[model samples]
Target: MKKLLSFCLGILFTSTLVAGEVGSDCTFKGKKLSGKVQFVTSFPDFKVQIVDSFPDLKVQKVNSFPSDCGKWQEVTSFPDFKVQIVTSFPDIKVKYVDSFPGVP
Candidate 1:
């Protein structure tokens, strides 16, 4: 019984370490989106916002990982579009992606 308990605790600890975490990973309001969209940025894990105005925004995560990652860029076509990720207190960066369709 002692051996069983020890093994269970060991596994729990291992899983916790292996699981990658997101610090403030959730986007503006905890939503994901798809659209006639393409990519201007990429990350292994990210939170995406779709529109300029708040309230009806969306978030997106990636599956095209381990192949082509570590790329982030600006929204070329939608030059007026904007996105912000929390940096420090009262600070954020606006990085938007030009999403057209099936590219991201």
Candidate 2:
């Protein structure tokens, strides 16, 4: 009861935060992120291993959707594209990979 409520609240907060990110060009929108991710070039770039994940970043050579909602799963290797994770106030960062795909 309490735990479930708390979990739901936490998810709600995270979802809102992800959606409230200003100037965010990412098309994926979910309470959680799925697929394996990797930084392209020591930079904040990240790449996931799957495509069914929510909110596909809309980058070529990768299997991502656009502005959706769901959970994020982690993979082992050979991700789809590059991405950055901002665990602070914003939760995540998908900006740097917006216009520039295949960057790592």
Candidate 3:
């Protein structure tokens, strides 16, 4: 009985750890992180921080065709998502790259 209880506890802990991993599917909290993006100062859909390394997602700024994961097109109007740049307490951390933009 003790062995079975221990096994169940182990499985529960492992599942919780996996559930906390973010941006694996280019989405965070059910919101897609790709497509046309807008930078805002207030009331953003997501708060982001730019980091040099160990990013949750590697982003590539594109002029057009921001279709894939981590590809973002900057736009002023009708944005698919809005992000606020924050130095601290960000929802996600990202790094800008020229190539290979996706979950790291």
lDDT of each: 0.32, 0.39, 0.86
1-104 per-residue lDDT for model 3 (tens digits): 99999999999876644323455677997878789999999999888889898888889999999999999999999999999998877878889999999988
Q: Local error of candidate 3 at 12, Å?
A: 20
lDDT by residue for model 1 (1-104), tens: 99999999999977644312212432222322232123334431222333333212223333332121212323335321233343222111222333322222
Report the backbone clash tally of model 3.
0
Instruction: List ranges where model 2 is wrong by over 4 Å.
Output: 1-34, 39-41, 46-68, 86-104
Worst 10 residues of 2 by lDDT: 66-75
Report clashes for each candidate as comma-separated counts: 8, 16, 0
TM-score of each: 0.26, 0.25, 0.78
C-alpha displacement of 29 in model 2, angstroms? Answer: 12
* Candidate 1 positional error at 75, Å: 8.2
Tell me which residue pairs clash in candidate 1.
31-59, 32-59, 36-100, 37-99, 37-100, 37-101, 38-99, 38-100
Could you tell me which residue pairs clash in candidate 3? none
Name the lDDT value of residue 55 in candidate 2: 30
> Whole-model lDDT, candidate 2?
0.39
Of candidates 3 and 2, the better by lDDT? 3
